[model samples]
Target: MSVDRFCETMCIATIAVMFGCVACITIKTPVGAISGIQETLTVDGRPYRMSTFLGIPFAESTAGENRFKKPITKAPFLSTFDATKNPMACFPSHLGGEIKYGKYVNFSEDCLNLNVFVPHSFEKNVSLPVMIWIYGGSFVEGATAIFPGEGISAFGDVIVVTVSYRLGMFGFIQSADGKLPGNLGLWDQHLGIKWVHDNIQAFTGNPNDVTVFGESAGGASVIFQSLYPGNRGFFQRVIAQSGSALAYWAVHATPNAEPLIAKKGCERAPDPVKCLRALTPRQLQDDDTSAWQPVIDRDFLLASPQEIIFGNSSHTQNARNFFASLDLMTGANNFDGAVYFRDVWPFIFKTTDMNTFNLTRGQFTGIAIPSIIADAIKPKNHNIASIMGKLLDFEYTDWQLPNDSATLLFSLTNMSNDVGFFYPVVSTVKGHSSLRKGKTYLYELSAVPTTHTLQTPNWIQGSNHADDIQYVFGYPLYAGPRSTGNYTEEERRLARGMVTMWTNFAKSGDPNQPEDARRFTNATWAEYDLNSQSFLHFTNQGALPGSRFEARRMQLWLDLIPTIALMETPQAHGTGTVHVPEIIIGK
Candidate 1:
């Protein structure tokens, strides 16, 4: 039989068997009654039973008039809803590619749904901690089917819910006159959280004890959600991995939507939103315009995320206080920049083979470093950009081997790591820990996987972006035949340790507390503070506590660079050395 026929036959057979017996599990949520599938999964050579409910809608269809507007909460189900399979993914920014689980998802405009996974052990009156996952695709592309929560729910002993929101222009499009305020995607997430907080009890989850966690853009999205003034009590704790609201790529203050509107023949229309809505999703998604990202629309975001987090103005004090009230865990991979650099290499360096790309010092300072600063920082003025570029070139360069191609490659990779991932993540941690009201923990994943999923230059070592995801989700313990890669014994142990710690943090306010501390190499995760600058370092051998991660380099980006950028004027460039002043945090 063909693959489609085989799949259809197996699906019909499975349904027949389920109907023949009392195998299906039904739970009555606030919306209505829904049925899910119960399956047995093996983790660490032990069998566990869990129930999975997929494709549960949280909001109404976001097609036509609702395209660029806030999502309306999904009404109660008229009858029993069969939520056994994954929902169609939101219209992706790009066309034709498999998402996380090697599944080619169908696209739809009405794709605001969520999936719930519950362990059979805690499917009754017991109240278990809940974890809501948001996938990251730079706010342009992502699907709920990517990261399945079966392993997390079964092994971590917490109820897991993965949410799906709108993507690309359909999710974020704005007008100068505020006709289409951006961040409709964010509003969709807010409604999903609210739905869970209101109705998770049916799945034996504690709404009060909930943790919102995500990686990459999802990580940034969680941080953005925490900063939103209206989400004061939506979730109690947050975990952001390799992404931050302060990251330059995460937020676009003033995105130009006119090009896309004009491309769709809507420029002449008095109401661009309506005109664009009239076109099919394919018509809009096929345009060559840049992907739509989050913006400061005064509704979802009152101002810049950085300003709201660290600013001392009286108006921002309440936002800071609310942000500080929630427990936060944020961190980045050691070589997070390698993945980003690899993607942008051909465009900037004019080469795909980075290993053979011999870079010169002149080109490094003139073409390479300047391009990175301009792209990442998006400095307003030429003078500011020029000053920042010179400062970075001086800081990132290896004086001893300045002319070596390999050394230049390494330096460029580190520069990307710092300005993009490390600086933003550390800055967010600093702002949160500075308040001292909420418990905060930081980490760095340096453990290299034996089997590499992402291709990087041999010179670049350490964990790349999203490398920590598999271990966190316990992929090794439950990877099936169609899984991407196989895991060794060491990887299995690492997965166990990571899942234990991640779930522990969700249960209580601490990762090392409430038992299973010894599973994570028996290392106590120290709470991050300005004094020690402590963080948990995950290595190949085991988890170890470290202090002042890349102290000198961090000082360069956080303290020295900002200070120089502030003092240097247009005429100061190439004139003489500029004196850098001390910057006190929270002053």
Candidate 2:
């Protein structure tokens, strides 16, 4: 027999003898020889001792007829499948934008794989809570393989799962009739959770105690899944870091399906769906033109987020179950808006690469203000706009410090952050606290860890968008955290605290209630509600009781801007409508 074949046969025989039962187990013999199965795992000679199963397929191929359709769960493996390596990520998707930082990654369509992590001593009867991680890339990028789950599983004594899903046009190209359901990416995540629920017991996980968590777009996707009626009981708790379903960029209000289909040459076909099926994945991804995003597909989302969350739903509000029993822990960074305005500062506003994209000053003015107010206040048929520009200038521009260069830049960044991130986070906290009987905890990440790579000025301290991901995942993780060319003891200290709080929330409904949780060693994170608007401000010291300063800052967008426009309605333009009252800050 060939040596390779002999080794494989022996490996299979060992596996059969050691794992005769359904539950996973590996036996080591006394002769200093590994027994009948795949043997031990280690990070050097010393072992963290976690049983890691990587690149396990969770769903069937999303190619051919499966394109733009819901995920179909894969059949059980008939033999030993090597899960030590990661599967190819969904095609044409960037691996967490690593390319921007001079890193390359594998990409392909057959990428619906999941990684499972459990303590080495884990037994099926021990039912540890499960935490499933979803990554963020504006629905365009990210993968599960980049994140390690073993350390977290060992740290919290819980099962950790990192999931991969379809991204870009492959997952979000919508169909006008809802026949080709566009939430394939979401459905992929849903199937992953369901798979874990059904099969995690074999690996020593409590299917009933699952928590979904992520940062940036991943955080927003958490809210999307929770609010949807289909995912009501899928997860027991949530940790949304630096993102929300209500964030302007989290979920787009419009559908870009028709344009996408047109790009695929299906606009004139008798059956558009059939034409879409004929094209290859590369055809859909080429030219990078697809505006793939979540839309108000009546199936997944019966109505828009505004209608459902803001009490304008078609059904009685009481009939809906919005986090009725689920606990929530969500928050954003202090300078969350810095990256939003990194390029467009000092009066240039915005520019485009395409020559046809040029707009005159008046037209550009409308684009500068919050999108909700721009069109409503813009003068029509004049090929120009002014009212909103003047209003925002009056509101955000610093007359007292007009000469300072960074003042206007900082002002715009703050406005963008509040409009897109902070306002929505606070709104979600308030909504859950008011609607649900379970505990709701909120936090703000302000630690400037030495690992942040985005080159912002020193003044822009506190955390920027998605900075908490590094701290929570650990600075010296298996693959190493994205560092900022330096290290400090205090930053690593902050990381431990963040990870503890997150895992505590996953293990128990309330983070602070988790007995002996590393975070609770210092403070009691108070529940956020309408009364105090309390939050935990996470710094090097620890999670501390912090008063919200956003109430006044958000007033500029939710009150002053809209109210002033209402007061000056006719003077700016007779076409201005009062329909924007819905944008008012929730009380």
Candidate 3:
């Protein structure tokens, strides 16, 4: 070989070696043997730590005989599996699956797992508070080891855990024959929370002081856990961002409402249990996408959260404890329902514009006639147009959808937030006030900066739905957090403020001390009252009080549809097809 060639080869080898070292160092953590892309850092002058534990099993795969059954806990972490590398997210679909910005992560049906982060060297006995985050993808899609979750773990000194639950048909499946039931997805979450409550202490967390927090579907989970009888005592405090139980797709407004129909508008299959189990995951996903929801199985979920909220259920404690006793905080991002509206508009209406994706008044009253009523009467009718039309007025059913699809879309988007997200939370607050459990604080965020990545077309600014997630977790965005060109300082402050408030709330019941009672300068957070419903408004200027901030919009929802809110123990709601424990023969 020529001398010149030898030198070039040697140099190339040397650079490759150097690059390998950088990758190793970046992926490995500085602490003990725990794995999965660990990072060491500090928070509040305390040594903080973060790591992603991809695909740690929380439940056995719900395939074959296991289908539709409650989640079965996995044995302790095995030494054979490397906890260090991000596992393929459990199957059928990956996290952020099919989204434009989707990242490639390993996904599988065996993907019931969670990620955890903790501060380094907190006095061993300190027993720092633990925050378990449930990601929101309308309960159909999302993963624990996502971007913002990792960032949020970095923002706090407390132990942070993000979980991945089963989604779509794999998670929720209502039986046509009433032999097989639904809500297995929610039960999976309950099992995971039970795992946390039982095992978080081993990881140096205060199991008793745990706070369950989530956005969108996740936010909905927090409300569910609080109200679901099976989930009582799982977490002490709750934080729900952008979704609620008293909203649409939650539960029906009236009691003894029709049963949630099965896939393809079928009420019951010939061999409901065996037939559903026989279908492939893809078959279920495609067939069951229309009404993926948590059901009020008298066993697991005694009464509907709606019934509990209205104080009309036999399980009064379910309502009382969820809304009244616990320290709870819930809010919605302004753009919470835009994506749904955008997607559903075209499917429901005949003349929707592909380019603009807006619905017309004529389309609303005509082709869209079934869409409105169909949505208004969910589960029971699912995709059955005839059944939904029977429940609501043909005129009121279609009504004049807003002239601009944006206007109607905005209303519909917020409807879920108002009815499903905000109203249930307020009802819980009001219920709590009646019970005299503790003070309930309400807030609304309305800062629309031009900086953050403007993913939605409606507006380049304004607090679109799920915007709070970016700020709450302090995740880096494409546009940064502001258009002011000041970079991420304000965003960082907001993140810090949120984390601090959340952690404090987890540690104690109250998020605010006497001195730091309000969320921010522009707002003096107020306890919710039935007569004077209000919320602390968060904007660039500061936080202040706003009356009936989200309630008025949702009130019309009550006018339009009836509902049932359940808030008591399982045994109380009578026989509404709840999941009850069967006798264990040998065990």
Report the number of the highest-lDDT candidate.
Answer: 1
Q: Give the TM-score of candidate 3.
A: 0.74
TM-score of each: 0.91, 0.81, 0.74
Stronger candidate by lDDT (1 vs 3): 1
User: Which ranges of candidate 2 are over 4 A from the true structure?
Assistant: 1-47, 92-105, 123-125, 286-290, 312-319, 341-367, 370-391, 453-459, 477-486, 515-521, 558-587
Candidate achieving the largest TM-score: 1
lDDT of each: 0.79, 0.65, 0.56
Model 2: how far is 333 from its true place, Å?
Answer: 1.0
**Candidate 1 backbone overlaps, count:** 0
Per-residue CA lDDT of model 3 for 1-587, tens digit only, reads: 74434443443454346334211111112122233333444443344444434454667777788876778887654232234445445333222353522364655557777766655433246577788888777666776656335444545456787777776656765554444566777787888888778766655677887888887778877777777656667777888877676555554222211232244334466655666567665555452234566766666566656556544444555554565667777766555544444455556654344446665556544554455444543334334445334333332322453466655444445543453445555655555556666556666767664454324545424676677776666443222222233435555456555655666566666555433634445344566666676666666555667777655445544433333211112344455333321100000
Residue pairs with clashing backbones, model 1: none
Ranking according to lDDT, highest score first? 1, 2, 3
> Candidate 2, residues 13-117: lDDT per residue as tens digits?
544564442223332211111112223333212355566666778888878888778888786654445554445677643332435422434666678988887
